[model samples]
Structure formats: C-alpha cells, structure tokens
Target: MFPSKSDFLLRLTTCLLSWVSALILVLIVWFLFVESELVWREVGVLRFLTDDRWSPSGDFSSAQFGLFPMIVASLLLAVGSILLAAPIGVGAALFAAYYAPRGVRQIFPRIVELLGGIPSVVYGLWGLVVLVPLISAYHPPGTSLLAGIVVVAIMILPTVALLTLSTFQQLPTSLIHSAAALGIAPTGIVRSVILPASRSGIMTAVLLAVTRAVGETMAVLMVCGNVIQAPSSPFSPVRTLTANIALEMAYAMQSHRSALFATGLALMLVVTLLVLIAEQQRGKAGHV
Candidate 1:
C-alpha cells in the first residue's frame, strides 16, 4: 500500500512539473504576442520584414524599422554553422564510437562533455581575442560572417557529437556483431548497418545543433562585427537577429521595445518551423 502511494505521488509530481513547463512556455508566447502587437500594427508585417533599414531609434516621424538585413545575416550564420559543424561533429561521433582505441573512446566522451560544459561567454571571449586576430591577419577586419559561423559551429559541435555518440551507443550490439560475423569490415558495417540504423537520431542531433546555431548570440555577436547588413561574403560583417535583439533590447523603448519583441516572435516562428520539419523527417524515417 505504501509503495503504491509513493508511486502515485511520483507520477503526480512529474505530471505537475510537465504542466508547469508547458504553462511557462505558453505564457512566454503570450507575452511576446502582446508586446509585439504594437509593431505588427504600426509598421505592418510586410514593410517591417522587407524594409532594408533598421533604425528604430531614428526620428519618431521617420524611424525606419526593417528586419531584412538582420534576417539574412542570421540565416547565413545559422546555415553556415550547420554545414560546417554537421560533418565534423558526425565524423567525431563515428570515430569515437567505432574507430577509437578503448582508452581514447573513454576519454573522447569526457572531452566532448567538457566542450559542452564550457560557457558561451568563454567561447565568445576566445573568439574575440584569438580567432578574431587570426582572421584579421588575412582579412582587414577579423569579425565577419565567417567568424560568426566558425564560433557558432564550435559552440554547437559538442551538442551534435555528444547526441550522435549517445545514439550510436544505444544501438543493439548483436546487430553489429552479426554484421562483423558476415565478414564485413568495420567501415562497411558502419556504412550499411550503423548509418541506416542511426539516421533518425542523426537527424535529430543535427536539428538540435541547428537550433543552437540559430539562437547563439554572445559568441557570434563578438566575432561577427555586428554590422547591420546582408551577409554578402565570408568576410562581410553582419548582425544576426539574436545579436540585434541583445544589442538593442536594453535601451529600446515604446515601439522600439515592441519591435524587439517582434524579433523574438520571428525567432519563435523559426523554431516552430524547425520543429515541424524535424517532426516530418522523424515520421518519414519511422515509416522507412
């Protein structure tokens, strides 16, 4: 009877915690909507999105409020980071899971954990001091779209690698042994068996890494030059949406504050789209 009551209490606690988390998320979405209503009405969604300028603090009569440049910049940073990090992260996971010596396999996870544990600010500081100078030596200014991509990629690499490694480790050991007994080489086994088996998990890991890339602020802000412009080249200085919000939110007021909230709303939309895409992919993989 006591065990039954304890089990019921545990279930109740978990249920309540889940509800609280969902409620918090809903409240945040509501707050963003309420705060962003002014900008949505005042500027109109079309112009706010299409306008090239982003001078919300300009004269009240002619203050320009646009998101194009920042949006492009943010997209460039996120996409670039994903492209660069995905292969490296996945490769690291594969190596750690299959190719590494036993001693190295044990240590590899610890290294990945340490990378994940490092603070974003430390990564930012490292980018500002070390990476910037390295890039600056080749390009006149070190902080550019490329710099942001590299920093964000570094920040998200551990997330991808760690998640992928966990997924790889969870696979049925007997399946791998069977492939090996069939006289398949390790590489062939990985290609034909491991890769196919882990596709869903790999996709999920990439999705999470992409989200981290999209939302990263401090490291990208420090290295990306923070200029409000479309990212035209690897060397082009640009500002991401997250960086813009962080840069302006503190001093924003009235419509400006609402505009920042609108930016938050945009980010939420991006994340929602990502979730939808991931779900679609997950469903397709399940069917396969």
Candidate 2:
C-alpha cells in the first residue's frame, strides 16, 4: 500500500530534522578538534588530562595546565546531584504515576515541567542569593561544592521525575492488573513488577539527568566558588570543567585559548558518552 500524503510528509520532515541535527553535531566536534590541536601538540594528551595544575600563564618553566582538579570537581558535582535527585525524583514519579488523584496528577507534572523550563541563569542567581546565604550561616563561604551539588540536583530534578513518570505510565495496564489479581500488595507490585519492568527506562532517565548535571555551567559556576582545587569535603570550594572553560574562555589567548578548547573537547566527550549510554538504555527499554 502507498503511504498517505500526511504520513509521507511527516516521515520526510523527521528525516530532514535528524540529518540536520547530525550535521550540526559533526560541525561542533570538528570545530573543537581544529581549535584544540595546537594545545594537544604542546601539552600531550596524558599531561593535559592528568596534571593537577592549570596555570596557563607563567614563565615557560613553571606554567602548568593540569585539569585533574576540574575533572574531579565535575565528576563529584554530577554524581552528587544524581545521588540526591534520583531517589526523590523516582519517588515523586511513582507517586504521580500510581497514587495521585487525577487533579494532582495533572497539576503536579505541569509544576515539575515548569521547573525544567526555568533558565539556568535564574537558578544560578537563586542559588547565589538564597542557598548560598543559608549555607554560609553554617559554613564560612556560602559558595562551595555542596552548593553546586544542591543547585544542580534541583535543576535536574524535573527532568528525572518527568521522564521516570513517563516510563511508569508506559507500563502495560494488563500486567499491573494481573499482578493485582494475584494478590500482590500495591507496594509489592511496585517493587517486583513495576520497578523491574521499568528499570531500563529509569536508568535512561537517571543517566540523562547525570548528563545535564555534568554539562551544567552557569549554576555551578555561580555556586561552586570557581576555586581550582580538588575538593576535600562537600563544603570545599572547587571548579568543574564546564565552569573552568566558561571562566577562562573570554580572556584566554594563544595557548591559553587552545587549552580552553581542549577543556570544551573533554566536556563534549563526556556528555557524548553519557548521551550514547542513555540512548542504549532507551533502546533496551523500548524492546522490553
């Protein structure tokens, strides 16, 4: 049978959009590579990645561009945000999917979606004004790793919750009904049936949230104190790879600029890996 006009138009439009997106991504990676090649030649990949100093300017003797601290800070911030956001987001998703009244089910999701729509800069400002002051009451400097983590967690919470809720909503009603008929308690049905069935989707949601946390710049830059030191504790100030690039890219020149491009390349690589992993999990979820 021939495809209808609407169907053909829809397929053509989607295919064109997909190719455009792929082309744009390729251009970005190519730009990063061309710009960063100079630094790669001078610094060597191992030292550029593993060294703990990031002084891009000094006498040729003492200048160092170690990224270990920023790398560590980025990992800590992303992981910490995931740790804090996952359980809360998942629980809220479960409540929305399985327990909420119809009105609440409608309103709550919109509220969460609105949270996601809020600008990153606004979140940064809020963190700096409200969260930083609150933390400063207990800790000396308000801006620290803890503040960054909290801000990121809040920023990603809506993403996780909405995605997880969609995952739960996708479960077959018949399967849930069968479990109910078999005398499983509601909680038991959730634990043994719903959770296991939606595991891949939940993992995808969590990974996507982690990706957002890893790539977040403005909020983290504002709250993380921009200190290029490995964090000793959650209260310690530290700079992340994204924050480092954003902070330095404006004034950087020559090798300094190239190094910042290298930092962006690193960030791109990390986010790309995460997106690929999430896509894999999403594919598995679709199959299940």
Candidate 3:
C-alpha cells in the first residue's frame, strides 16, 4: 500500500529534525575540542587530569590548570544528589502511579512538571536565601558541598519522579493481573514484579537525573561556596567544573581561556558518558 502524503511529510520532517540536532551536537563538541587544544598541549594530559592545583594567573610558568578538585567536587555533587533524591523521587512516583486518587495524581504530576519548568536561577536564589541560611544555622558557612548536594537534589527531583512515574505506569497490565490472580498483595506485586520489570527505566531515570545534577551551574554555584579545594567532607566547601567555568570565563585570557574550554570539554565527556549509559538502559528496558 502506498503511504499517504501527510505520513511522508511527517517522516521527512522528523528525520530532518533529528539530523539537525545531531549536527548541532557535533559542532559543539568540535568547537570545544578545537578551542581547548592549546591547554592540552601546554599542560599535558597527565598533569591536567591528576594535578590538584587550579591557579591560572601570574606567569604561565607558575600557573596550574589541574582539574582534580573540580572533578572530585562534580562527582560528589552528582552522587550525593542522586543518593538523596532517588529514593524520595521513586517513592513519590510509586504513590502517583498506584496509590494516589485520580485528581491527586493529576495535580501532583502537574506540580512536578512545573518544578521542572522553573528557571535554574530562581532555584539558585531560593537556595541562597532559604536553604543556605537554614543550613548555616546548624552547620556554619552553609554554602558547602552539602548545600550544593541538597540544592541539586531538589533541582533534579521532578525529572526523576516524572520519569519513574511514567515507567511505573507503563508496566504491562497482564503482569499485574497475573500477580493478582496468584493472590499477590499490592505491596508484594510492586516489590517483586513491577519494580523488577521497571529496573532499567529506574536506572535510566537516575542516570538522567545525575547528568542534570552534574551539569547544573547557577544553583550549585550559589550554594557550593565556589572554593577551589577538594572537599574532604559534606560540610566542606568545594567547586565543580561547571562552577569553575562560569566563575572565571568572563575575566580569563590566552591559555586561561583555553583551559576553561578544556574544562568544558571534560564536562561534556562526563555528560556524554552518562547519556550513553541512560540510552543503554533505555535499550534494555525496551527489550524487556
């Protein structure tokens, strides 16, 4: 049978859009790599990856561009946020998917979606004003790794919840019916069947949330104290690569600018790895 004209147009349009998006991503990666080559040559890969110092001013001979601290901070921020948010988000998703009244379900997901839509800067301001002060009362200097973790956890909550909720809701009706026929309780079904079936989706959701946490800038910057040291504890101040780039790009010059670009490239690689993991999980979920 011949395809309809509208169907043909729709496929062509979608294909073109996908290609365009891929082209844009390629261009961005290419630009970052090209611009950062100087720093790679100047600093060498081993020192760039392993050195803890980040001083980039004064003579080039004295300057350092090691990103180890920022790398550690970024990892802590993402991992901590995921640890804090994933359980809460997953619990909320379960309630929304199976326990909430219809009206409550509708309203709750909408509220979550709204949270996702809110600007990052607004979240930053709120963290700075409310969360920081509250933490500072108990912790002294509230703008620390813990603060960034909390802020980024909140920032990624909606995403994790919504994705997890969707995954739960998409479970096969037949599986639930079979479990019910076998006299499985609701809690037992969720524990043994639904959750196991949706494991890949849950992993994808968490990975995606981690990616967002790692890439977040303004909110983390506002709460993370912007210090260059490697964090030894959750209460210690630290800086992430994203925060580092945003903090100094405006005044950076020469090799300093290239070093920033190199930081950006490193960040891109991390995010790309996370996205690839998420895609792999999604592929597994589809097969299941």
Candidate 4:
C-alpha cells in the first residue's frame, strides 16, 4: 500500500512538473507578444523588417530603426560558424568514438564534456583578451564578423562533437564487423556504412548546434564590434540581433523598448523553427 501511494505521488509530481514547464513557455510567448505589440502597431511589420539601418539620434521621431543589418549579421554568423564547426566536430567525434586508443577514448570525451561546461562569458573574455588581439595584428581593428564566427564555432564545437560521438557509438557493432570482414578499409567502412547509418543523427547535432550559435550573445557581443551594417566580408564589423538587444535594451524607451521585444520575438521564432527541425531529425534517427 505504501509503495502504491509513493508511485502515485511520483506520477502526480511528474505530471505537475510537466504542466509547469508548459505554462512557463506559454507565459514567455505571451509576454513577448504583449511587449512587442506596440512596435508592430506603430512600425508596420513589413517596413520594420525591410528598413536598412539602425540609428537612434535625439528621439523616436528622428530615429530610424531597421533590423535588416542585424538580421543578416546574425544569419551569417550562425551559418558560417556552423559550416566551420560541423566538419571538425564530426571528425573529432569519429576519432574519439571509433579510432581512438583504449586510453584516449576515456580521456578525449571527458575533455570535450568539460569544454561544454565552461561559461559563455569566459569564452567571451578569452576572445576579448586573446583572439581579438591576434586578429588585430593582421588588421587595424580586430573585431568583426570573422571574430564572432570563430568564437561561436569554438563555443558550439563541443556540442556538435558530443552529440555526434553519442550517435557514432550507438551504431551496431555487428554491422561494422561485417563490413570489415568484407575487406573494406577503415575509411571505406566509415564512408559507406557508418555515415549512411548516422546521417539523420549527424543532422540533428548540426541543427541543435546552429540553434545555440544563433542565440549566443555575450561572446558575440564582446567580439563582434557591434557595428550596424550588412557584412560585406568576413572582416567587416557587424552586429547581431542578440548583440543589438543586449547593447540597447537597458536605456531604450517606448518604441525602442518595444523594438527590442520584437527582436526577441524574432529570435524566439527562429529558435522554435530550428528546434522543430532538430526534433524531426531526431525522429528520423530513431526510425533509422
């Protein structure tokens, strides 16, 4: 009877907690909509989206608020960093899961897990102190879209590596053994058997990593130079939507404050889309 009561309580607790989480998500969406409504009403969604600059001089009447540059920067930063990190992260995962020696297999993944544990601010600080200077040596000012991409790639690398490693580890050992028994080289076995088996899993890792890279703020803000312009080159100074909101939200008033909320709303939608994509990949992986 006591065990039955305890089980009921546990089940009830989990159900309540699940509802609470759902409530929080609904609340967040409600809050963003409520706060952003003013901007949508005032700016008209199309004009707000298509305007080409973000400059605030004396007041709201004289100021121009454009999100295009920030939007472009954020996309470039997210895509470029994912492109740079995906291959390296996948390679590391393959090495750790399949090719590493007995001793290295234990140590390598622990190092990667530890890297993921480090705080974003610490990465930002390191970039500010170390990486920015290194880039500056090549050019007059070091902070640019390139710096943000490098920092974000490094930040998301562990995420990609860890997930891919888990995916690789889950592959059926019997299949690998059969391929090897057929006189296939290690490289050929990986390319033909393991990679095809793990395609959906690898994509899930990449989409999840891109989600993180898109939402990253502190490190990007510190190193991205915060210039509101479309990035013409990797070296061009740029500002992301996250960086823009972080830089201005504090002192902003009225329309400006609502604009920040609108930016947050945009970010939320983008993240939600990425999350949906990742979940679809995860479902495919499960079926595979």
Candidate 5:
C-alpha cells in the first residue's frame, strides 16, 4: 500500500512537471505577442511585412522593422544546410538500417551518437579554426555564406541521421520482403518500397535539420560574416536572425531591443508553423 501511494505521488509529480513546462512555453508565446504590439504600432502591420528597409536607427519616429532580409537570410542558410545534410544523413541511415555489417553498424552508430553529444561551442571552435580557413580559399573570404552553410550542415547531420535510423529500425522486415517478393531489384526495392514507406520520417528529419539550422547561433556566427546585407551568392557573407540576435543582444536598447524580440517572435512563428505541417504530414502517413 505504501509503494502504491508512492507511485501515485510520483506519477502526479510528473504530470505537474509536464504542465509546468507547457505553461512556460505558453508564457513565452504570450510575451512575444505582447512585445510585438510595439512594432505593430510603430510600423503598422502591412508596412512591417512588405517594406524591405530596417531603419531602427533612423530619425523617423516610427523606425522601419521589415524582417524580410533576416527572413531571407534564415531561409537561405536553413535551405543550404538541409541540402548539404539530408542526402548524406539519409544515406547513412539506410546503410545503417539495411546494409551495414553488425560490427560496422555498432561502431558507426556509437560514433554518430558521440557527435550528437558534443557541445555546439566545440563545433563553433572547429569551424573557426578549421572550416573557416578551408572555405576561404574558394570563397575568398573565410566568413562567407558557404562557411556558415557547411558548418550548420555538419552540426545537424547527426540529428537527422539518428532520427532516420530509428525510423527505419521501427519498420517491419516484411515490408522490405514484400518488395523483394514482387521480383524487384534490391536498389529498386530501396527506392520504391523503403523510400516511400519512410517519407514521413524523412520529412521529419528535414524539418528537424531546418529547425536546428535556423536556431543555430554559435557555429553560424563563427563562420558567417555577420554582415546585414542580403547575400548575392553562397560566396557572400550573410547574417541570419539568430546571428543578429547573438551579436547584438548584449547592448540593444529601447526600440532596438524590441526589434530583436520581434525577430525572435518571427522565428518562433515560422518554426511553430513548420512543426505543425510536419505533424499533419505524420498523420497522413498513419493513414497510408
């Protein structure tokens, strides 16, 4: 009876903890929405979204806060990171799930797991010392968009690969066998059967990669030039929302602080929408 009561109390405590966490998330959302009202009043809704200029330092009473440049930069970095990470991640996942010999699989997955455990700061350090120099030869500037893309790609690869590996492991062997039963070649089976069955998981991995890339600060800041200008090419230095926030959050004041918070609100909004879309896709996969 004592053990049962203890277990009940433990479960109840866990439930409370979960609710507390959820409440915190809700409060964060509310705070962002509340702070964004200042920008709305200053720039108005339409101009804030449509205008390209960000003249928060200007003499105009209502300083411009168009997030378009930051939005573009974030998307560019995330998209580039995803492109660089996804293929190798998916390939490694497939190999680990289907093709790896037992000895190789055991060691390789352990290595990947270790990669995930490393701190983001270490990645930034490595990018600063190694990746930045390597890219500068071709880029002509070490801290270019390509450097940011490559570093972010490497940082998120382990996450995507591990998630995909888990997804493939959860799949039934009979699914693979069924494709073989249809007289399909192994490669064809992987393409038509495994790939189709794993579409939701792949999309989830891609979304995760995008989220990490968008939110990543240290490695990106280390490699990206931190220039506010729009990137003309992968070789150009670019600044992202996360980078800007990291670089300026220290001394930002008044409207500047509010604008930074506004950027955070925008980033969270985009991430939340993407997560919802991924969830919907996951539901569709269930129906399939």
Candidate 6:
C-alpha cells in the first residue's frame, strides 16, 4: 500500500508540473495585455498600427507610436536573412549528413555547434568590427538593412544547419538504397529521396530560424543602423522593432512605455504562432 501511494504521489507531481507550465503561459499573456491597455486606450488600435511618424517633439503626449514601419523592417530583415542562410545552411547540413568524409564531417559539425554556443554579444562585437568596415567601404554610413540581414544570417546559420542535419539523419536508409538501386545518381537520390522525405523538417527549421532572426536584438542592434525611418533600399539605414524598444524604453514615459510593451506583446504573438505552426508540422510528419 505504501509503494502504491508513492507511485500515485509521483504521478500527481508530474501532472501538477504540466499544469503549472500552462498556468505560467497564461499569466504571461495576461501581464502583457494588461500592461498594453494604456497604449490601446490612448492611441486607439488602428492609429497605433497605421501611424508612421514615431518621433515626439515638444510634448511627449503627442508622440507617435506607429509600428507599421518597424514591423515591415523586421519582416524584411527576417526574410532576407532566411533567404541568405537557408540555402547555405541546408546545403552544408546535407553534405555533412550524406556526403562528407567521415573525419571532416564529424569535426565540422562540432565546430558549427561550438559557434552556436558562443554568446550573442561576441557575435555583435565581431559584426561591429568586421561588418561595419566592410559595409562602409561600399555604402557611405555603414549601418543598413543589408548589414543587419547579413549579420543575422550568420548568427542563425548554426541553428538552421544543426536542425537540417538532424532531419537528414532521421531519413530512412531504405529510400536512399532504393534510389541507388534504380541507377540514380547521388545528386538525383538526394534531390528525389532525401529532400522529399525531409520537407516537413526543413520547413520546421526555417520557421524556427526565422523566429530566432526576428527576435534577435544584440547582434542586430550592433549591425542595423537604428534609424526610425523605413529603408529606401537594402543599403539604407533601418530599425527593427526589438531594437526600437531597447533604445527607447529607458527614457519612455507613461503611454510611451505602454506602447513599447505593446510591441513586445506583438512580438510574442508572432513567435507563439510560429511555434504552433512548427509543432503542427512536426505532428503531421510523425503521423506520416
């Protein structure tokens, strides 16, 4: 009877931990919404989103908190970075998983994993030193949308590569063998068998990588010219929503503070959706 009670207690503890996690997520949503109410009340929802001018001149009360430009900037940067990183990262992942010499493959992935473990600050510092000089030579003032995208691409490459590599590793050997048995070339086998089998995983990785790029602050801040205005081109100075919040939150007053919280709330919403989508894809893949 004592053993039975002990087992029951353990099961109850595990169930409680799961409920606790769900409760914490609920609390976080409530906190952000509660804090953002001031902004919604003051600006009205439509104006807060559609208004473009963000500067407050004489009166802090009249300051604009339009997030459209910031949202566009963040989306553009995230998309550009994914475009730049995905091909290279995914290619490297495939090579490592399928084609590379055993010794080199083993060592290279470890190095990439080590890169991922490095602090964001270190990446930021490297970007400031290397990217700033490189961009300034071509573009006059250095900080630009391109620089931020490039820096973010580099930062998220390890994540994308590692995830893709895992996907490739999980693919069944029988598919590859069957392709080879049909006299298909190595490239054909990869294109026909491995890629199709791994499509869901690759999509999941891309979503996760994009989410990481979108939310990244320190490295992006170091490289992205934190201009409030929208970019005229990839070479033009631009600001991201995360960078803007970090830059202004300290000096922001009442409603301004609340507006920043609203931005945070918006970011959280986007991230949550991406995570859900990824989970759904994973579930479908598991069913397949």
Instruction: Go through the candidates in order and give each one's C-alpha lDDT.
Output: 0.87, 0.90, 0.89, 0.89, 0.81, 0.85
User: On TM-score, who's better, 2 or 4?
Assistant: 4
Q: What is candidate 4's lDDT per residue for 1-288, written digit by digit as tens?
A: 547888999999999999998899899989998998887776767766666567643455566777888888999999999999999999999999889899999999899999998999999999889998999899748898999999999999999999999988888898899999999999999899888888888999999999999999999999989989898888888999999999998898877888889889989999999999998987885332
Task: Give me the runs in candidate 5 sitting further than 4 Å from their true place.
Answer: 1-15, 49-62, 286-288
Put down candidate 6 lDDT per residue, 1-288, tens digits, no spaces.
537988999989989999998899899889888988887786766875767687632343667767788888999999999999999999989889888899989897898999888888888888889988899898768888888999899889998899989888887877788889999999988787788888888888888998899899988888888887778889888889999988888897777778888888989999999989987876656212
Q: How well does each candidate superpose onto the true structure, as a TM-score?
A: 0.90, 0.92, 0.91, 0.93, 0.89, 0.93
CA-only RMSD, every prediction: 2.8, 3.3, 3.0, 2.3, 2.7, 2.2
List runs of model 4 lying over 4 Å from the truth.
1-14, 56-62, 286-288
- Per residue, candidate 1 scores C-alpha lDDT tens digits across 222-245 of 889999888667998899999999
Candidate 2 C-alpha lDDT tens digits along 251-276 = 98877888889889888998899899
| Candidate 3 C-alpha lDDT tens digits along 1-288 | 427998888888999999998899999999999998887887777877776588876656788768888888999899999999999999999999889999998899999999999999988899889988898899878899998999899999998999999998888888889999999999998899888899999999999999999899999989889988888888888999999999999999888888899889888998999999999998885323
Identify the superior model by lDDT, candidate 4 or candidate 6. Answer: 4
Reference-based lDDT, residue 232, model 6: 85
Candidate 1, TM-score vs. the true structure?
0.90
* Deviation in Å, model 2, residue 80 alpha carbon: 0.4
Estimate the lDDT of model 1: 0.87
